[model samples]
Target: MDFSIISENLHYYFDGLLITVQLTGISLLLGLIFAIPLAVLRTSRNFILTMPIRFFVYVFRGTPLIVQMFIIYYGLGQFDFVKFGFGVFQEGFNPDNIGNQTFLWKYFFSEAYFCALFAFTLNTCAYTIEIIRGAIESTPFGEVEAAKSVGMSRTMMLRRIILPSSLRRAFPAYGNEVIFMLHGSALASVITLMDITGAAGIINARYYAPYEAYITAGVFYLCITFTIVWLFKKIEKRIYAHLAPYVDKTQKTAAVN
Candidate 1:
């Protein structure tokens, strides 16, 4: 219908798409980095090491992502410490008379962007921990026995065997997690971050064309989903190459024809 409106505001959608990618990419990277060590620790028998990580994962995975974003974005400002910019200013403070001291609060809870990133990072990290933990626990019993026979210490076995093998096994599941994270990034718009969904909402409000606005946004998301699926498929094939049944090239070509 209103193709002209979409054409006119294509740049806005592109900008929003960029923000969406940045948010998802950074969140996934940080989540994976933190989850690796936490997952390893989570498999330990010691309650001291495992309980805190378990509780962290439980709380994040148990709550809605929107609630987490709200608590980080709107709730933090209610505190006097964050409200006053970590004590740099008080009530009715003037921007013109700002102090020279660097304030750490301004970069974190004080900004919607950082708050959204913080929430997404922690939320994805919680799920990722469980994904990797399951992979680690599922390591074949014979492999563990072989490692023990060769006098491999826990640390050495994890380093040389368990982590590498587990990570490969977790690859498919993690790809799904990445896709979920991309979809979840839509919630960033709720916190005033102009992600793809945010751009669509703005267009719908301004032009009164809900179908055009949202369908365009949906197309963008679909394209991203396709790209992610293709990339992950490539990586998954490589990761599990050894398990694939060998096929003659001549037969493959004949089937294709």
Candidate 2:
């Protein structure tokens, strides 16, 4: 296959890759922000506290990411109130025909970039919350008792023991979410976001060399995935370093036996 197409369009690919990374990073940050509180609430025994979180998670997790993006970018435009009410950039903002598409509700809900960011963030939050909640539940009862025995208050126990432990335990699953979100950000192209996938699509369209165009995108994706995996491994090693001694001792004991 002709790999020249990729080199010729390197600038486009670079710009697209940057956009993709920006979208993924912002969405992941927002998802973490939302997920933590929702996850804490998810661990609650109370129906009132958990039911809303349950419904939110169910809706987001059940829907396809593309559909969510469409709803945010296209479907919402159908509603006059949503288009005009939430939309800002009032200067020369034509509230009459949103079909002209001036504003998209700035901060995190406007235009292609913000809408894509908002949708992905919500989608990631649903999955991340579940992972974190599971980690929280998995925190050992013995550990809880140990914290209590040390005269640790509930707040102190949560701050010093539960949150850190849960985050450490959840890292692997959360790392997968990061990779998935990065891959999924390609959908931003559907809304004219010009992300990495969009750049690939442009190259393919221009050169009519689908193989060359897509192969480059695939390579970029693989590199990002590997980088994420490496970072996660480093983080896991550092976070779980305390368990290394126990693990090594156990290995030695098993070998001796």
Candidate 3:
């Protein structure tokens, strides 16, 4: 109903969208980087290594992401040791001076962006580890055996055969994970990060126009979702191109002859 407000706040909406994208990109990158090792650990034959990873995955996956975020952001701050270890407080740190520090100094450790990034990265990594573990496990045993038959070392077979095939099989699921991360980044706003959802909430409070602000944010999210889907589809096609069958008329003619 209020087209003018939407137009006037378009720049704010765009800024929020940028922040949302940034959070998602950073979190997803960190998650994937950590996930490979965790997945490997999960699949390891060593019970000592496998059990911890399995437990981590269970705890992270079993809990609601919101609860995890709160635990990291608020609950962790309750402990003096955690605060000190995370650099949230200096030696002999006193809470009374928290508000008097410069913005950068005060937020150096307790910033919403970092907290959100930490929470989302940890959560995404748990999910990605399971996905990657499944992909690795699903790699055809026969192929591994064939590689070994050719005198390939375990490392060589893993690097040359297993990882590549597993990557291809994992891409589709990873793409979905990417999209999920993007959408989940909206939660960053809850911790006061001015992501798209946060900006919408702020603008709605100021303008008393929740519908316009939220709808605009929703549209921004939809655009991001579409873009991610399209990009991943392109990646999937490129990666799996070799799997496509090529109909060779020349071969057919030679056979007939």
Candidate 4:
């Protein structure tokens, strides 16, 4: 109801929007980089390799994201060992004479940004590994055999044949993941990150205008979602173009003649 309050703090809202975008971008990039190897492991024939990957994916995917964030931030901080580990007391390190030693760790590393990033990265990786595993598995068996027939090594076949094909097939699903990550970044607010949602909450509390603050946050999220969709469309068009049917006019003419 108070347009004046919303207008006054527009810069804060924009800053929060930027923070939200930054978190999503960094987490998505880091998560996918970690996920590829995990996906490959999931498809491994070796039980030793496959079992752990399966367990990791199962546990993360099975739990709620909020619970995971809480455990990483609050739960881990509760342990003396985790807070001040053996590594902190390594030969060259000394905390005894330092003033406010624990204060620095709690303030910087335990901040909501780091905690939310950690949780979201793990959660995204779990989901992405499954998508990648499915795509890799769906690569045609005959193509792999043909690569082998040509004296291709396993490494060569995977590098030259399998990965490219699988990536193309997986693009659509991966695009959906990108959109989901953008929306899910809102959860970072729960950990006290001043992202769009968190900033809106702060503004609403101050002005008692929940409707306007929340509406602004919702608009920011919508903009991000649409932007992701547009970018993915461009990438999909470029990547999948080769898969489209070719007319081959010369071949048709030759057959007719």
Alpha-carbon error at 125 in model 3, in Å? 0.4
lDDT of 2 by residue, 1-257 (tens): 88776787899888998999999999899899989978988988999999999999999999999999999888876765565664544566567674654344444456788889889999999999999999999999988999999999988998899998889999988998999999999999999989889998999899899888888989888888899999999988899888885555557778677
Q: Per-residue alpha-carbon lDDT of model 3 for 1-257, expressed as tens digits?
A: 79698898788888898899988998899999999878977888999989989998999899988899998888866765454344445566665655544443356447777888889999999999999999999999899889999999988887899888997899999999998888888888888889899989988999999999899999999999999999998988899889877767769977676
The lDDT of each candidate is 0.90, 0.87, 0.85, 0.84
Candidate 4 residue spans exceeding 4 A from truth:
87-108, 245-257
Best by TM-score: 1
TM-score to true structure, per model: 0.90, 0.87, 0.88, 0.87
Highest lDDT: give the candidate number. 1
**Each model's backbone clash number:** 0, 1, 0, 0
lDDT of residue 126 for candidate 2: 94
Model 1's TM-score against the true structure: 0.90
- Report how far off residue 143 is in candidate 2 (Å): 0.5
Clash pairs (backbone) in predicted model 2: 104-110
- What digit string (tens of lDDT, one per residue) describes model 4 on residues 27-79? 88998998887887788899998999999899999998889988988887775
Evaluation by TM-score, superior candidate among 2 and 4: 2
Question: What value of lDDT does candidate 1 attain over all alpha carbons?
Answer: 0.90
Models ranked on lDDT: 1, 2, 3, 4
Q: Quote model 3's TM-score.
A: 0.88
